[model samples]
Target chain A: MTEEIIIAGFGGQGVLSMGKILAYSGIMEDKEVTWFPSYGPEMRGGTANVTVILSDTRISSPVLHEFDTAIILNQQSMDKFEKAVKPGGVLLYDPNGVIHPPTRKDIRIYKVEGTRAAVEMGNPKVFNMIVLGGYLKVKPVINLANVERGLQKSLPERHHKLIPLNLEAIRKGGEILEAN
Target chain B: MGELRLMKGNEVLAEAAVRCGCDGYFGYPITPQSEVMETLMELRPWETTGMVVLQAESEVASINMVYGAAATGKRAMTSSSSPGVSLMQEGISYIAGAELPCLIVNVQRGGPGLGTIQPSQADYFQTTKGGGHGDYRLITLAPASVQEMHDFVELAFDLAFKYRNPAMILTDGALGQMMEKVELADQKPRWTREEILARSGSWATTGKTPDRQRNVVTSLELDSEKMEQNNIRLQAKYQQIEENEVRYEEILCDDAEYLMVAFGTSSRVCQKALEVLREQGVKVGLLRPITLWPFPSKVIGEMARKVKGILVVEMSAGQMVEDVKLAVFDACCCVPVAYTGRMGGILPSPGEVVEAFEQKLLKR
Candidate 1:
């Protein structure tokens, strides 16, 4: 019966892909889910945002004006979406790339340098995985085990060898942030 | 039921088509709808399951291939967005004239000219009111959910064969690009080629038979009276679909003072509007027409008997509202149907639609 979460950042930061992982996890948990992204012109270096709604009942609207959780990967994203995070909600920011920080005091902000963490693991593209990992621990919208299975099924057979790396990135993200 | 996977809407549609054992698919590259072709190409259905996946050079050629495949009583389909679909009107007319069953899908983008690659529902008139010439109707289905994207493929084929007419799955870019969960249906009880061919071969041009006259398929005729008869037959079939197969969904309209009507993705936003409006203690209802051609006029007319006003919400500029007006004769019963929406891929928020429903249907 919970509401919505929004993930946003500059293009190529894999914001939408991370949102998709959450959507897959939510659906695996038998929740009604819907995902929407900024398409076309708004996708090229411009700000990108995706809305993911997971609920115990049918999802009436896929569009969310505010968020129960907000994830931003860059300063532009934080500048655009920081104020839009729902009152008394949660916020996550990439500690590696963002310069501007939200001054709001009501929401919990988790600063995980997602790209730097993925690069430290020798795969910057797995930044999606790092964000995915942090999302799992932060929002219990679905089971972490199920999200891993979804990633396995979604990736190609040739890319199966990389699943463990992605999982490792997620684990590192969870460990690195929760310790801080 | 199965575990959830992250897949694009177009990818989901192609997977559903293959899982349903669809006989043939033909398509060209068009934004918003191009993924349909890309997924089918990647699926290589023929190498896997004897499914024929062919990419045509043009939308015209793709639709013609659909016409050819459908003549054999096999499940055949082609997809494009608005401009590409415009090029397909010629072939759609030919398919209609020949009375062949085919499924067409339009993942609409903003249009009139080369509208940018975003979601738009502006193709309403071009779809339901005959984008081609002569008097004919395509069984147009507007799906609001990704699950509907999977289910409606079966439903489109069923309705197409049930009437020997072309059916279109009218979706938009939002539905095509978005990701969602789809629990595919069981496949053990599906229709086979043998059964469909047996039922359809009597009128189809399968082969030349010595015992029977030469089988030829054509929409052309030299006889004027026969052409008139053919038109009348098409009209009669349209009437059957209109009277019997119209499908729509109504929410809280019986006690509603205000009503909102929208289809496909727009209807989903209207649903959100219903949620917020009710929280603010507004008596607004949403009517979603699943079948765009059948228009859900009868249902809306019935609801008009109870409600004081109706607000038409669409992704287009007032195309379906015309039907609402025609359905109620614009009666002076406080059942006045008002209209508002945007063009191309810009979807109004639940808040914006709620504002319109309140302003037009409640206050005025």
Candidate 2:
């Protein structure tokens, strides 16, 4: 099975890191993964996006036009990537700051208050993890154990103590996801 | 097995160089490829492997430093993007002339001059056709994946040393920036002084030992006939490489009616295009050239006789297509060879390639 995902948001929102964690989780499960980010001026305090492909076989092109899932964190990304989602695919978004929600009829849409949950948890850094939690709930492609290991692998050794907190944020994100 | 880690292609290249027992890395910072030097700095291989990593003031200086290190029979390398690579052309030519064994990586970005910092294969002709001048060929390896990016480091070094000529890894910004799972090479110890003397002592600029004639490394041949002889020798070595080191991969060509030729990032895109065309009842195949210098002309010539048409795909305004046409010219003159390319770092999608097939090759 191959799942192509695009995660897009503001530059500072850990859009690329979330995709990195997901791709690493694919590796943890003995799968092939590719993570390609939109580089250059688009990454300078503006909208940034990363395409992550997890496949059982070899992945050909890291740059893709369509995605099985589009995880949008802002209105700009929602407007940009809503139509690129494949039919019967999942489009997860954090309802916080998305002025115009996705209006695609063919794909599945889910909203999780990831930013609000992060604020509640007293750590804004876990916001992306919460959003990732929402994605895992909707797709369930990668298991929690692999994702926990992925976090451990992606993060620096000094940050290992924060794994439990990030796990809590992810679980809370799954718990708070609302179908819309 | 070595440890598996998810890394960007540029970063993994540095890691592979260190692990492969590279002696030194000298390169200037360039966009889409600075990570090569950056990762080397962060890893601090000086402490572990004694791999000297230095940031030179300019691309010219970096390449010349590589030339100096390589002349000493040390495993030295440098990397840059298109514009920066252009600056190093003279130094590269000198290295090729001196028969220096070194590795040069071009993480190509789009350009005639100062183009966008996006992926481009425009440097294909420049690289394979000898960018600097005066009769020489670099063993060019084009890597389509991050795994190959790691693997080609050692392969390029080995080929460079075996032939005593410069070798290059021709990649693009897309592969440089993309991240993938890579099984790294086992850590190799750097070559000892005794090893260098035993292996390359005949020509290496290590020093003038009392027992042997003084070894001199020079590209200057003031005598016209002697220069002609030098060119002939370089050509003979290139001919040897052409015969022995031609590497390519053919995908789904068993029953293919049409063939698409591509390399590096374009090959990956064409792989997807091949899948799409097959789904749409088009009998198309992909021919990916792993070694660009030894252009795989023989394989393409054979395939050209069987396929009805050829489609050349690249991130340039048709460079390698000239080689493709030259390869197939004598095989079948009637068979049409069509070219489709994206310039200035624009990457054509799979659907676009399929569209090009219909427009250029398929009959309506």
Candidate 3:
């Protein structure tokens, strides 16, 4: 099986890193994966996005227009990517700053309080982990063991001590995600 | 199995360069290609393999630095994006004229004038048709995967030295920035002074020796007779390359009726489109040119005779299609030749590609 996902948000929201960790998790699961970012000035304080593909076989194209899942973190991302999700695909969004929620009826929509949960946990940087956890909760294609291994692989050795905090953020994110 | 690791294309290119015993790397950072230098800095190959990695002020300076290093019989390279590559054309032309061996990587983006940071194949003409000036050809390699990004660095260097001419790895922003599984090559030690002297001692500026006369390396020839002779020599070498170095890959072409020609990122997309078209019972095939300069024109000409139509897809306004047309013109005049593409940072989807094949080529 192949899972094509797009994660989008503001620059500092860790949209790209989340996709990276997810791709690494796919690697831990012994799967083929690819992570391609929307590079350039758009990554400097403006909107940022990344396309992540995890497949059982070789991946053909890294540049794709459609996605099986859209992880929207901001109003702008939702506005742009809501319709990009395939029919019956999952659209997960963080409800912190979204003014107009997604109204698409073709795909499954879920709201995860990723930003609010990170705020409660007293760490804004964990916002993306929570969002990633929410994605796993809906899909659950990759297990938590692989996710932790992925974090170990992606994070620096100095940051290894903070794995517990990140794991907690992920669990809280998975718990708070509600289907709409 | 060699150490399998997931790495971005640009980073893998840097690592491969170090592992391949590259003597020096001089490059200026550009969008979509900055990671090449960044990875080198982070790896600190200077401390490990004694490889010299310098951040030059401009692309022109970087290419000249490669030329200087290569003249000393050292394995050297420089990398830049589209606009920066344009600035290095003069230096590149000089390197070719002087018959120096070096590698140049162009992670192309949209063009004409600082178009966009998005991936593009617009530089196809600039790269294969001799970007600089005069009658010269850089052995161009178009890599479609991150693995090829790693593998091609070594191949580029080998080819560069084999013919004593510049070799290029022509990729795009997407391939440069994308991450995938790559098997890293084992580290090779830098060449010793003895090895350098044995290989390039004849023409290299290795200082005057008591036994042999001093050698000079220059492209300047005041006498038109000497200049014409130099041009003839260069043309003969290019002809040898064309005869022996043409490289390409044909996918599903044996039973194919419609042919699609693409390279680099566009070829990977075309591969995906081929699968889609096959599902719809369309007998489509894909031909990807690995070596753009030696260009597998003969194979394309042969395929043109059998296929009913041909579609040339690119991330530009169909620059490579002109070559395809010339290759097929004499073989099959009745075969419909068409071009469809996306530019300015936008990538065409498999659906769009199939639609173009059906509408433009199959319809005819």
Candidate 4:
């Protein structure tokens, strides 16, 4: 099986972290995973993106014109990547930050206040975790427990206390999705 | 043969060097290949064996350290990315000039300068054609995968010793950072101390014995006559390498009308393209130069008589294609200058390479 996703937004929006978390989770599951950041002048601050490929087999090229899913966090990201999404693919948008929405005729679009959800959980850094929670609810590639373990393992010892709040954030994000 | 372990290409080469009983590793940290140093540091192989590991101040010192250890007639190696390798060229030339056997690994990144931190096979010509100086050859090996990184280390060391010349592993960051399931090779017999001494004792500067004269390992020949003789000896050794150590990999060329020339990561991508083209009934083939030095001239020279044209793909602006043209000279039966390239860390896709073949051969 293979899963390819693009996490995109302006710099400092934590889009790259979502990609890293997904890739790290895949590694924990004994899957072949590669995380490649878009390089050169493309990353100069207008918009930045990362491509995460998780597969049972080797990943060939890191370039992707389209993704299986796109987690767009800002207006620029949505405007740039929405058309590249495959027919019937999903777009997870951050309604609190992204002002523009896709007008495409063929795709499932979910607009959640991922940033607000993260702040409500008492940690703004858990914005990536909230997205992960929604992603798990949608895909279920692995159990929520595995993702929790992955988060613990991903951080160094100095940041160990942050794991619990991130876990709570994940649970809260899932509840938000449930209420919606 | 054994179970596969998930490892980066740089780590694979480090472990391979240890298994081959490499006497020492002297390297500085550089991106795309920092894991090589990290792996060697974590291994701490010195606790049991006497293998020395030192991080030098620069590539200049590291290559010189290899020069010293190799004079002791033991296996020694150093690794660097492109810029570092460029810095070490004078030392590399000195090692070749003095006839020392050591391994140099170039985990290539894009460059005419500090280009970027990405994989590129742009160092092909510098590696193949005496980048350091004065009519000499360093046996070069290009690996296409993490598995080959492990497998090629022993071959590189053995050939370096056999020819008493430096050998290089030409690789890139993609191969370096990439994690893959790799099979570790079983251990084998290594050269004994006496055997090493016998092979390299002629001029190792090991100190004077009462029974024999002192030896020095230097390329300095003050007299023009002596320098001429030294150049002649170097030429003879290079001729022997050309005859015996030309290594290459050919794939699906049985009825190929066009051949794709590539090495390192580009070769891996080209291999994927070749498979696809064959499925589409395009008779595409690949000639991947494993030893970029010796140039694999004989193969291309012979192919010049058979194929319609050769499509040379690289990560740089047409460097190795120059070598390919030099290899096939006037016997150019086809449009040999065909090139498809991208710069610094930007790798050509298998799809991009497939189109190169299709445009040149299938559509024609």
The interface RMSD values of the models, given in order, are 1.3, 0.8, 1.3, 3.8
Q: Per-residue lDDT of B113-223 in model 2, one digit per residue for the tens?
A: 999999999999889999997888999999999999999999999999999999999999999999999999889999999999998999999989788998889999899
lDDT score for candidate 4 against the true structure: 0.79
Candidate 4 at residue B55, lDDT?
98
Best by DockQ: 2
Q: Tens digit of lDDT per residue, candidate 1, span B1-364?
A: 5534556778878988887878889999988878887888887878866888888999999999998988777889998899999999999999999998889999999988887788989999999999999888899999999888988998998899989999999999999988877786654233465676477767676675577776567789889999999999999999999999899988877678778889988888888889888888878788899998888887788778777778888888889999988877744344688898988678877878877877776673
Mind giving the per-residue lDDT tens digits that candidate 3 earns over B300-329?
999999998999999998899999998998
Model 1 error, position A51 (Å):
1.9
The residue ranges of model 4 lying beyond 4 angstroms of the native Cα positions read: A1-50, A54-59, A63-97, A102-180, B1-20, B38-45, B181-213, B223-226, B271-281, B300-308, B326-332, B335-337, B350-364
**Candidate 1 residue spans exceeding 4 A from truth:** A41-46, A178-180, B2-4, B186-194, B330-334
Q: What is the TM-score of chain A in candidate 1?
A: 0.91
lDDT of prediction 1: 0.82
TM-score of each: 0.93, 0.98, 0.96, 0.79
Regions more than 4 Å wrong, model 2: A42-44
Q: Which lDDT values do the candidates have, in the order given?
A: 0.82, 0.93, 0.91, 0.79
The digit string of per-residue lDDT tens for model 1 on A1-180 reads 876888888788887777776777676677877888877655568778888888898787776567788887878778778888878888887766777667888888777778878778888899877886786677666777877876766667898898788888888778766422
Superposed on the true chain A, the predicted chain A of model 4 yields a TM-score of 0.89
Using TM-score, give the best candidate's number.
2
TM-score: which is higher, 2 or 3?
Answer: 2
Candidate of highest lDDT: 2
Q: Which ten residues in a row have the lowest lDDT in candidate 3 chain B?
A: B329-338
Whole-model alpha-carbon lDDT for candidate 3: 0.91
